[model samples]
Target chain A: MGKIFDFQFMIEIIPSILKGIPFTIMIAVVGFAVGIVIGLFGALFKIYKVPVLNKLTGLYVSFVRGTPLVVQILLIYYAFPILIKLINFKFGTKIDISWIPAVVFMFIAYSLNAGAYLTESIRASILAVDKGQMEAAESVGMTMWQAMIRIVLPQAAKISLPVFANFFIGLLKDTSLAFTAAVPEIMGQAKIQAGRASRFFEAYIDAALIYWGLCIILERIVAFIEKRNKESA
Target chain B: MSNVMIEMNNIHKKFGNNHVLKGVDLTVNEGETVALLGSSGSGKSTLLRCINLLETPDAGDVRINDYSFTASKINKHVKLEARRRTAMVFQNFGLFANKTALENVTEALITVRKKSKSEAIEIGRKYLDKVGLLEQANQYPSTLSGGQKQRVAISRALALDPKIILFDEPTSALDPELVGEVQRVIRKVAEEKVTMLIVTHEMDFARDVADKVAFMSEGQIIETATPSEFFTNPKNERTQKFLERYLQRFSYSI
Candidate 1:
């Protein structure tokens, strides 16, 4: 307890945690890409108020947004498989549905969580585009969907870029939750290393530093994109 | 007889209880230019927007050449077909902020009209040249001056080669110094015999560019005549009063 600081131990654990960086980045990229697709269609449904789907998507976003993401990960990874087993049992069908990868479950959980927040961000950005833009697009014979995809969405993308970038970096950090599902991302690797060495503080500090460095690099990328958008606009 | 380019009958529109437009009828012969002259809240813009189905009228039937659309039961196919024949230029320019001037002009052609990209670019360049904005084709709307933005909007509208064009106070949002450039473009389009319906506050521009002028007050067109007669000898007392007030502001007397 007297010797609290351990610089040498921290330096030693850095390489072990660094090995998890690629997995962490991959989970974030795949999860966020899936989220962008889900979020775009979800937002469009809500924005256009498409019958029952709109209400259903609203409930989904509200439920996901209302719950903690960690709980969602547990529910999706653990409870979802049980639910599927129950359905198969009730139907009396021999379906080999248990072969799905743990990584897939982690991806689903992260994407659903990110998508809920993205729905609101993307919807608001689309709304922020001037209503006249839609009118102008339609006047030139663009259908509602065409106008949205081409005119409204392109402009909305610019408005929502900064928010999206922030969410992306946040989602990257959130990949640590993948450890709960045994996905072996950054936190998973760090936790194992700390447990083996009994140097939890040192290992955790290295993990934090890695996250900080990655986030700083990502922020620069976001700034470069924002600058390019501004210049072209 | 000249073929009818546009016909709107008994158009009725209300924003809740505001009653912006009520039972308005307008016809535009092919190649005719009509200017809608009215003060704010007079529903000139609403009337123009109804033709494109931007603001669906509460009750009306609109015919643009072969396509017909009824407000009560809007047929999306017919509405789209009708809208394809018309273009609109907004007071705020309404150029796509994310697109370059050339892209703004070419987007609809490539997407809705399904022209090949090369063909769309060729047409877009032609219109940009026509508007004298060829040099600025690669520039985005935010970087352009107001006059340049409006000109680009005009180029975008013109590139579609619509049968009719609607301008809702195109120059009203421009600086005084910039208005002349847009007006000159409009004058050139008029000379090309494009059917246009413009809602404007610039009385002199209206007189100079409109083949016919219609004066509206309280959601009704009180008078329609040749621009010369409408400006110098309006029939309705309301038209006279409105023009007098407008002209007086500019230190001109009828």
Candidate 2:
């Protein structure tokens, strides 16, 4: 074999991959932030079973979770422009579809997928807060909602942090799919550079290394939070 | 003539096929401490919970300070008025694990009474100090001992300045040594002339502190008397048997 590894090849792609880091981090951060909100609301809806809204949230979670992230990215990218046109027709006005819309669509897809899993995790942790604690709050003449907000949710968040952190890391990795919509995130930029230079193997390896580094950093943060929670508990 | 603080008239509660409280009637006068002594599943806890509307009674009326809470004939406004005057402390220390001891105590004062944070904190600090936990004000419940947590729960109830406090076996979860600390805090509150309805098995504490004692058996009050009267000369055979069983089981001669 010529060379098992090529240091020069790896070194050449470093600057190009570094250039895409901001985009990669942006997609991950935005996707996780949006997903957390959706997950919290979705979990609350399922917990309370708020009539029609509950059923709709359940359907959204199942639909998003049942399909693959790759398929969702492709569908959101392709359907977004057409959906905007239909909305324009109904409203009797034109609406432009742009990069922001694509990013938003990709964010929604990733977040909702993360949210479905988080909903279950959050709901379970909320239940684990103990029934006696609730009874005690009520005995003190607190209304149901007040007790849930002041007493229950804070404790539940402590329990939910680990699972939430795991979902965030997974969401970060899934940002690779944003490349399909020409979002030009790290993976997409690496692929474009590799195509131009005919160095596909080198480029993909760089992408893998970048992803591995991010996951390691995220894992340490999650571990630290979990340790703190345990010490407090 | 003692002014009636709380009156339960023919209160009944049923859970599916289980008849928990069968027309249980009890009353406590203003500044009176009534100990509801009973074996497990005798509807003692259920009666206390019903007074605060934590568990709604199926039939009969609970009147606190002349405000009837029975939903049968009274309007919604009347029921809401009565619930405001009562508060409960649970068997397990129901301190909010997330909040500091001071925050948990002041929450109701801020939310319900519309007291400012500074004012609520002042009131909360007084009650916490009364319970001997003012130093632990900033500590969360998860860090406290069983007795300290229960004391915080007591302070939370007292911060509302409720007319009546219901204690549902407040010291049941405490270590044997810690039980006395909680009992002393409760005893101090009793001395302040706060009307209380206590469901407990702490016979000596109940005997020493209670103005009246009501013994319940199979969802009914089988005996009601002053502590001396009940312990010395129990009227009903059921009360006699209960005293005998406990006195023998714990090997304590009364």
Candidate 3:
């Protein structure tokens, strides 16, 4: 308790944690952006039931959603190396993978998790759009795909924005899991500093505070978007 | 004149166990306004939907302009061409809620016809002005009242400039006072020589604007005639019973 307010210790560690902010932000932004792509494809596949692809997409979504995200991150970072090696033997080429591989793996895992949820949200919103709208678009010389893209998706997107934003913030928090891959994100750096200086309590507290602050800001932004959407609607 | 702008041959549709349209046949000449009148579930709306391929007929041929669309035998190209020439307006004003009224009107022009944005907007504004919704051009669907939304929907259909426009109970969703505004818009379009197929309950509007009226019942068109003949001297007993029942329900003089 007496060591909790070690001002000099906190001052020294602040810069180290701040240095990791870029990685933290990168994981969140990239993961979420990729997640949206996955979500859009997942949604399209599920809604249209495109031959064999729809079943494959369902399998992927179910697998991703059924597994815990933390286990997924670990398997992607660790077990994936052995899988790649096996594939490399089959292809007869030694594949040169980099740290980028780990980042991409993390992105895939987080994106897929968010995508499963987003797909459900998008599908529901799309179903809620009146069926007459589709008939009207079709009658006006627009093909089925044209009606989906130009008419149905736009209205469905407005309905889905709030849920999408919430998923984005969840993806941000999930970035902390990337540290297991030795990615040196904010949480990783804080843990490293705490280990070296024997200040685990102080370092972890600061990390939790930063995460809470980010969540608050994201919530505000989501609220603003929802309000604007309602007013426009 | 072309033999027919639209020809429906033995159209039949069923939903689950219920028969909606049963062995119905109809035809519309070029530049004609045909009103389909019936009690609910009497197949008026289902017939209109079938004509546009919105509701696939369980059995029938829907010939529009030069293309023939049959639910069982339609090829992709035939379906495409049939859809391209026909336009429909719905009872609930199915405007895309996210887009401005003008954008909703212009979406097909740009997406399907490959018109430039500026060109589509120009065409959109023309049709919107035609429907008397020019002032509401930039407004979203949520901003408009029921009648205004229907007007915008009318403009959207008109923007395609299709060979014919089908209205499925166009004024049914509007307020009692607001129904006349949408009806007037439809009347104005009809006066401009636009070919139309309307399913409606507005007996007065049907009488005044329709070149022909088809009365449907129990999944069949029981009778069809010029509005005066249909109203004053309906031949089918079912048609007379329906008109009498409708007049009684609405408490209006027929």
TM-scores, one per candidate: 0.94, 0.92, 0.94
Each candidate's fnat? 0.85, 0.60, 0.83
Superposition error at A25 for model 2 (Å): 2.5
lDDT of 1 by residue, B1-254 (tens): 99898888888999998998888888899999999998888999999988988887899888987777788987688668878889999999888877899999999999988999999999999999999999998988888999999999998998888889999999989999999999999999999999999999988899999999988889988788999999888889998898888867777543
B-chain TM-score of model 2: 0.95
Ten-residue region with minimum lDDT total, candidate 1 chain A: A93-102
lDDT of all predictions, in order shown?
A: 0.89, 0.83, 0.83
Which is better, 1 or 2, measured by lDDT? 1
Give the Å shift of residue B173 in candidate 3.
0.5
DockQ score, prediction 3: 0.73
Tens digit of lDDT per residue, candidate 1, span A61-146?
99999998889999998877787789889998666656777888888888888888899899999999999898888888999889
How would you encode candidate 3's per-residue C-alpha lDDT over B93-112 as one tens digit per residue?
87877689999988888887
Clashing pairs in 2: none
Which prediction has more favorable TM-score, 1 or 2? 1
For A84-202, candidate 3 gives per-residue lDDT tens digits of 78888999978766635566777666766777777777778888788877776777777788888888888788777877787787788888988888878889989999899788877
